[model samples]
Target chain A: MNKFYKNILGGKAGIIGLAILAVLLLVVLPSSLQIFRLNLVGKYLTYAFVSVGLVLLWGNAGVLSLGQGIFFGLGGYCMAMFLKLEASDPITTKIQSTPGIPDFMDWNQLTALPAIWVPFKSLPFSLFAVVAVPALLAFILGSAMFKRRVGGVYFSVITQAFALILSLGIDGNQGLTGGRNGITDLRTLWGWDIRSESAQYVLYFVCCLLLIGCILVGRFVVSSRMGRLLLAMKDREDRVLFSGYDVASFKVFVYCLSAAMCGIGGALFVLQVGFISPSLVGIVPSIEMVIFAAVGGKMSLLGAVYGTLAVNTGKSLFSENFPQLWLFLMGGLFIAVVMFFPNGLAGLWESARARLSRLSPRSGAAKKIIPMPAMPQASNLVETEPKLP
Target chain B: MLAYSLSEIWSILIMQGFSGLSLFSVLLLMALGLAVIFGQMGVVNLAHGEFMALGAYTVYLSSQLTEAYAPGFAPYYFVFAIGIAFCVAALVGGLVEWGMMRFLYKRPLDTLLATWGLSLIMQQAFRSIFGAREVTPTLPEWLMGSFKPTETIDIPINGVFVMALSLLLTAGVTLFMFRSRIGLRTRATVQNRAMSEAVGINTGLIDRFTFALGCGIAGVAGAAFTTIGSTGPDSGSRYIVDTFLVVVFGGSASMLGTIVSALGIAQTQSISEFFLEGTMGKVTTLMAIVFILMIRPKGLFPSKVRS
Candidate 1:
């Protein structure tokens, strides 16, 4: 139990970090910010789910999926479908040509609910679909790609193409998937007024707690034996494969796990934001999700959350003041993050702490500081086998 | 399913095929540059589309200038513009290679991210310079009308012109790559960088020029694009995925593969678009490419080289 606590919770430093994140998210922000601002933060925390997933998939497993938005959008759309159905109750939607169906469906001349959407009517089903749908898709995609050993840049490109296809598919299917306008006017979840300020506050807390839960899950994964295998596989896949482990299965497992996390984030996103759209599920948003992971120190679970928060905050601020400049700033951030700070904020924090400990002679002497070995740098995370023809 | 007459179906097929050829040319142009950058240098340049856009904007600018200051040169400005676009885009590509890409040779994924950033910056720059609205160059009178090969089949002259230009560029590139001394050096460097360097070939310069050449081709693509569609700040982004897919669907290294894949993709998309909705056609095309890629992970004609 002691070992479990230490390994899973990341020992003393990890516990402290979790405590700080919890207090800040649950106590500090909720108490300080207005409901509107808190809701926005809640929305940003949803992306933190994806960032955390990226830490596991990209950071540890060495698989860079540029289409996380597909999972996020799927989850959001699943929740939105249920909420839309509830919102479009027969009594409320009697004015439409076909009552009880979503307004977008009516607009697109869908007389009855589509077969795909029928399962989403139940809350339990919708919730399950949120995670399962993305996981299933991830499982299919991951298995196909990994089993063939199609990885590295090819994987990223294929994932991106998938993102494009999904967005285009949704946008094209106007009657079925709500098209470009998306499944909007989402309100009420199981007789509860989700739009109310009190509900928003509750949802924010729920999001924070769920986010923390995900981080813990991530920490547990990273500190386990599987994590060591993942690290080894990432640096040297050939060696790992030669060592008699099913390498493809591990990759698929991690990929599906990340997809599930993104799905949860997406569901929470729909809950907080009141609508789900194709705009948030496309190639652009998919790549942006990666930046969150990249900016947060892809290797650090806690850093992913902080990175998402920091980048989103900066985006909100920049876009609000100078919308035109935001793209430039964002571009600069992408370049700067990749070029100079490859390991992200977590890396910076680790190095800073190392430097501080080295400088403080008294503390070092009193604590009998054991000189730790250097952490693996991002540069070493290159593909061992050449991908070029 | 059989709604139309046989001749009508033939005409529709012919016209769609012609339009597909235009798309093929544009895609081929874009993919050629990408193939060179990705296959030769192993750099995943997400910003290659921006170079194409740079070329497009150059044509737009030249058109604007010709109309404003040199009205007599309006008919002739387009030919010069294509060349100027290539030069301008190549210059920018070379600068980017020197400033950014040189530092990211060992890190292909990092290059992808950095190039994405570079693309974003370029998009914003385009937005700032030319307002957010899409712009098109005024084509020469000769390039405007259609060539009626059949009574019903009205093939757009611009489409034919773009195809011819792409063919010319492709042939030139093929010759330059296979026949030229610099091309030999580039191939040698790509095959073995350390060996090439030890043999006194300036590998860094080769890398820069190869990247520039790729961007230059993309610029020509952009120039060709203006005849088909308008140029926007985000136009490059719209094509980036399709271009990357084309390059990947083809074996990344093989020019012949790139051409074949471009043709296959363009034809599939255009013909499908004729029957299905616009977005559905795109979805179908992308899905097909992905499916093919899954079956053959290294692409249709992967080069036989030992890792």
Candidate 2:
């Protein structure tokens, strides 16, 4: 029974954590939250996908990408293209000078759809493109940088530069993209009304299911040999490289995987939010995505999802009432999370659990103490083992 | 597009080249401070541009004060403002280093996120105080207007002033780093923190002072920047990526590389803009930087060092 418990849930705490998230997503949120608010939660859950990917990439592999928004935007734009085309059908857009093409293109005096838009007309193609585009981009970028041994701060700044370039490109190409306003007024997906109450509820459940799947994927990866290799790489890249591991390939694979995750999130974000824009793919939003991961507990995939919900909720609440103080509050959260709670919300939970277990009467015999290294290595990156005593 | 004569095109290229030089000066000023902080301390300070913005705001405030109460002092207020900008930025940098940065020295990624948060606060603070509009200080008579170096090659006096200021600061920084006792200690601490501490060097003080000095230079850069560009709450953010690119492209630890990369990036961006659309120009420059970095990940001029 004990072995089964450990194998299935990883730990007793994991079972409880999973149960709580399931209740929140499957029961409480759909019943309690109104359509408007439920849709907002769905939007926030899309960001959770990115944060979960960040848990794997940053927490495990020590690759802190500040440009996940690029993937997210790419995914979102792909989905938006299909929906925009459907909404701008010849019958619907007959009043415009150019019918059948997207309104923005018509407004910009383009007679035909751009070559890129042609492939996105089919739902299967759009769905495939949503994941493929970001994965391809990440693969190219990751291989280029990682193969050349560019990791750490240089990798981060270069990614941010990429984000800047993409936003600039999208915002400038008004005819192709919708410009600053983004692809909005998205009406349907395959003749189903997206803005309806029933549709919103259905999409929310779909988002929750996808999020759970992502968590399971994260759990599986973290428990596998590849996960151990990532941790090893993070702590000792040189040692891993010396051990005959193709470190760059692993990094590239993880990066591409993470990009694919963000891409999925971005596509979902558009579906729920009804818009996709350049603003969401820019430097500021990209960094904000990192903050969500950091705040949630970069180390925990489930915690990252919760963190996204918590931060986004706080953001909407604060911005609605006190717009001016939001930035200061966010800034304070960033500093506090890093300085006091490096492991974030999940770390707090773990520490609390340890304390609770120790306070129990039978704790002395039940607790298992892990031994520390004789002389802790001089490297600052060494992970400190948790102590029960 | 090529309707102009060959001579006209020649003058246009020269004019654009000079404009690029002006951009190079600003980029160098911002990258210099970032290089010091990131290279020596290994802290990715996202708030570095905000320090520059603080400097720009200082100049604007002083100009306003001079215009309202002391018109006679308007001619010399910019010089005084430049000094004040450095001192103010340095003081804030020292406090931040002491209060927050000291604790985060071990976690570079955390430092990056925390500093980004700090930058958001700073940007909002500026917005609250200065309002959302961009502001520029009125140029004094001496600093205003362009002079013709040749009939077709006119250059703004303010741009020249900024370039001269950048040259002066770069020379001063070089002399201080290679010539001074504190410079020696800073380098020692960066090279071997434990050894420097063992040898009785106050590593903590070195860190604080180095961070402050770096920020101070960024402040002066901001003051110089106000002469060329307008300042707003988000002004710092706009330049942050470009400044970081300059630092990374030049090889983070090499001061000479920072200068060269700054000039190269600025010129490429400026010249390319003349040929392509403005957005495309920026895209091309960024792509070039990424491509170059892929081929030579250590950057164009990596310093010889072993960690």
Best by TM-score: 1
DockQ per candidate? 0.85, 0.78
Error of 1 at B216 (Å): 0.9
User: How big is the positional error of residue B254 in model 2, measured in Å on the Cα after superposition?
Assistant: 1.4
Off by over 4 Å in 2: A1-8, A362-389, B1-7
Per-candidate TM-score against the hidden true structure: 0.96, 0.94
Q: Which tens-of-lDDT digit does each residue in B1-307 have in candidate 1?
A: 4898899989987887778888898788888889988888878999988998999999999999999999998889999999999999999999999999999987777887899999999999999999999999888899888988778999888888888998999899899999999999999998888899999999999999999999998998998889988999999998889999998999878889999999999999998898898899889999999999999998988977555
Clash-forming residue pairs, model 1: none
Give the clash count for model 2. Answer: 0
Compute the lDDT of residue A81 as modeled in candidate 1: 93
Q: Candidate 2, residue B71: CA error in Å? A: 2.3
